[model samples]
Target chain A: MARTRLTPEREHELYTAVLDLLGEVGYEALTMDAVAARTRSSKATLYRQWGSKAELVVRALRNDKPVHLAEIDTGTLRGDFLAVLGRSDDCRMEKNSALLRGLSHAVHDNPDLFQALRELLIEPEMTGLQLLLERAVERGEVRPDNPALSYVPHMMIGAFAARELIDERPVDRAFLLDYAESVVFPALGV
Target chain B: MARTRLTPEREHELYTAVLDLLGEVGYEALTMDAVAARTRSSKATLYRQWGSKAELVVRALRNDKPVHLAEIDTGTLRGDFLAVLGRSDDCRMEKNSALLRGLSHAVHDNPDLFQALRELLIEPEMTGLQLLLERAVERGEVRPDNPALSYVPHMMIGAFAARELIDERPVDRAFLLDYAESVVFPALGV
Candidate 1:
């Protein structure tokens, strides 16, 4: 049977439906049938388009998220840090956090999903962040061997996870500013 | 039928079983029936002791994990920091990380579980860390109003998580020490 390819609009709808279902049911409980029912698409169509649920979810994340860090040449490292961290404000923090949390368990079980998330979803962001740091190092804003250089992503992502899991707070503008000033800046020797 | 109260040994067994199941099955799919089957305990007894799966898992974590940080007074703030962060070694890090990852999805779904985890598991550790900081302050090893003091938990926890999620590395003793020396101590002005 010939598979019906979805238009870009339909593909986006499929992605939204997949992410929403993931947030609700998690990767373990999410089934193609549920996605089909929710999107009024067929299981065959989903499978035809993406071989597995993990592939579908990974694509959805890649498509929806700002995978590449925008050219954030803010001149100062502090400015660049704020520009990057502040972008989270544009994201649906609760939904994103919930989705990550739900997928947290299943990622370990599925190597393909884990690799896709790391390579496709997370790696690009890390590259952009590192580039930003590299530019700063060139300008003598930060030292080349500063250990905090390697941990910039960790601190930011960790803080994001901590905010959701432990603090139960939103990573708002004020919070990012405080974090940059108090946490990232000091560590980076800014 | 009268419910049989579990002795300390039985309770310990139950906690171990629940935690083991949580690492294996995750919180969403974990059921009272599965727990009963795994532990060879009656579902009625399980329900009688703990109201729900959330309660069971929470109690299990509190019992199995070090809910409180021990006296980590290493005289210096850096020493105390190393002592506290170094404790991941004594834990079943892989199992604990898996258990945490599995529960990440459901923690937000169940407020009771979230509250129990934060209060019982995380808050006490935070208190111990703060005591370590206070002693450092008294000894003039750290300043009274250093902004870094407030963010110590966030930095350490964030680094731990970042190492796991982004770096795809273990928060082993060597990694923790390197992190403390390079990232943490610099931030704290030690």
Candidate 2:
């Protein structure tokens, strides 16, 4: 007999479980069975809901951002960037094992992973930063043609991944934000 | 029976093969067996020479500094940064699939990949830039206490990588240099 299909609530529950696994295992070691077992859902339900581990993880990441990236309200460009890029936040630093491992491993093996990573991980952050920079440009705080303007957000965040994955550091938010204000913003002339 | 160790002439042949493979197959897909076949050395010899992929790759990157980076002689700091970065001659921004994959993958697993990448990639260019900045400081073109001096390398190069990896475009060196001059140097109170 077929088991009753997983409801939206149940799927979200599993997604929460997936996030937990992502934190625990990193992407390389995260497996379908593990996610299923942890969530108390069958592998069949997981596959039916999200198709594969990558899809499930991407789904979870998609769900994670609205909760993680809190709204920032600092008035100055430096203040706003600092608020958004708080070094105390896990998402801001390179220490989110799941996000990095997922991006690194997923890009190599699955186009879906790459697309999803770009959409979920890269896009939201880029768009958020563009909005920030646009605001700064309007306030006349930053140059309209600042080249680092186009690239700094991505660079600041990506450097964390590069540092942890390559430099073997913990990728803490303090270190990242300090580096950003000291290096990135100054380079942007703001 | 033991086979004779590879001669220095044979070792050089093998190192060249690794470079070609690094630019061709990437770090993850490369293997000792494949390298042996490329170099016409037996797998035993390859294993005997290097224990892991990380070690082998580090050796390859450390082999020698090419004329490309050392040749930049632009009269100004901004010109020098532009000349070395985003230029086609050095393949710095080329984003060779094999090379990036290798670097990205190897760095994730090995502790030493960071040092190798720094020494092989980031440090050479940064060291040169540091010298240029020092000269500028002596000439009173820039301040000795400029905060931008501490981390511009990461800002510029990290910006380029972020543009390539996330934005999915070829990094614009001209933009980077312009950013340095218009935004970065000026903010340094130069």
Candidate 3:
């Protein structure tokens, strides 16, 4: 008999279930058994498709967090930055921060998960931001070799994420926006 | 007969043994058995004196790392940054980073270890950095309300240390100093 093909709807259900489980149980606590149970799939099915908890979760996260930042190429640097950074009034950044902690912890322990996490999830956002910076550089808004650009994003996002994970505090939108505008943008020479 | 009072020489020997064991096995791998084996000290003595691994390691690191720059009072912002950041270049910072990871992994998992490690080791360094920033603000070097100041030290230094620990890469003085001059100084102004 031919293998049963998983429809797009089925895939969506599994991936969505993975993300919901992630938010509930956290990355470290996520188990293959749990994923299989939540999605009403067999353990053998989950195991055959994704070798480990980390791989499944990382892929699920990448699929779930489709960055939908509207590409607004406002002429001015401030306009561009505000366009990118102003969305934080909705508290998505805080949710993203928690997701980052889960991802970082997952990556630290599993090399395959690390590569997938960075390549699929992190690189896209980083590339998008870098494109934003490239536009500014073209516009001559900042110095060509401003060193703060190197670690500014990681510092702002990583610091907030790390602190929240370690301290169990909320990563609020106002706080994230404040940091992006006041600290990150300034460091980047925006 | 009363237990023999440990002379300074005996204490130094014990500290060296602890550090050696720390470098080799790290915090998790380290055990009272290993420490006792390395130092040829009774495990009872270790328990009686330090109470736990956090206490023992904290005392060991403090004793081992020579106090270099604290309470930096340089007139200029650049000058002050150099003073504090320069200390990170010392050999002590190398051991310090390893010590941090060893301790961070432990404390992150166990609340008792977390409180103990924070109180004994991490708090002092954080306090020092905070005071240095406070002084800089008082002297008109940075804005009074720069919230980034709260996490700036961690952002710069912690990011570097974290990257090193995460990537298992070389973290040298020249690289860090350049980061200080570029990323750190710019972030301070805005």
Q: For each candidate, what TM-score against the reference? A: 0.76, 0.75, 0.82
Q: Model 1, A38-132: lDDT tens per residue? A: 99988988888998888899889767764257468889888776666566553565567667766766875788888878876787778888898
Query: What DockQ results do all the predictions give, each relative to the true complex?
Result: 0.51, 0.39, 0.42
For residues B70-159, what per-residue lDDT tens digits would candidate 3 score against the true structure? Answer: 556787767766665665655667667767666655655667767775676556767776777777888888898876676574466446
When sorted by TM-score, best at the front, the candidate numbers are 3, 1, 2
lDDT: which is higher, 1 or 2?
1
| Residue B62 lDDT, candidate 2, scale 0-100 | 51
The alpha-carbon RMSD values of the candidates against the true structure, listed in the order shown, are: 4.7, 4.9, 3.7
The lDDT, on a scale of 0 to 1, for candidate 3 is 0.69
lDDT per residue for candidate 2 within A34-109, as digits (tens), equals 9878877778877876777777888786665533333554666788866655534665333345466656755776
True contacts kept of each: 0.69, 0.34, 0.33
Give candidate 1's error at residue B96 in angstroms: 3.2
lDDT of 1 at A56: 93
lDDT of 3 at B162: 42
lDDT string for model 3 (A21-139, tens) is 88888777888888888888998788777667766776776666534333657887678656655544445556666676566555556787777666666666677767776777788
Candidate 1 vs candidate 3: the TM-score winner is 3
Evaluate residue A41 in candidate 1 and report its C-alpha lDDT on the 0 to 100 scale.
Answer: 84
The alpha-carbon deviation from the true structure for residue A153 of candidate 1, after best TM-score superposition, in angstroms, is 1.5
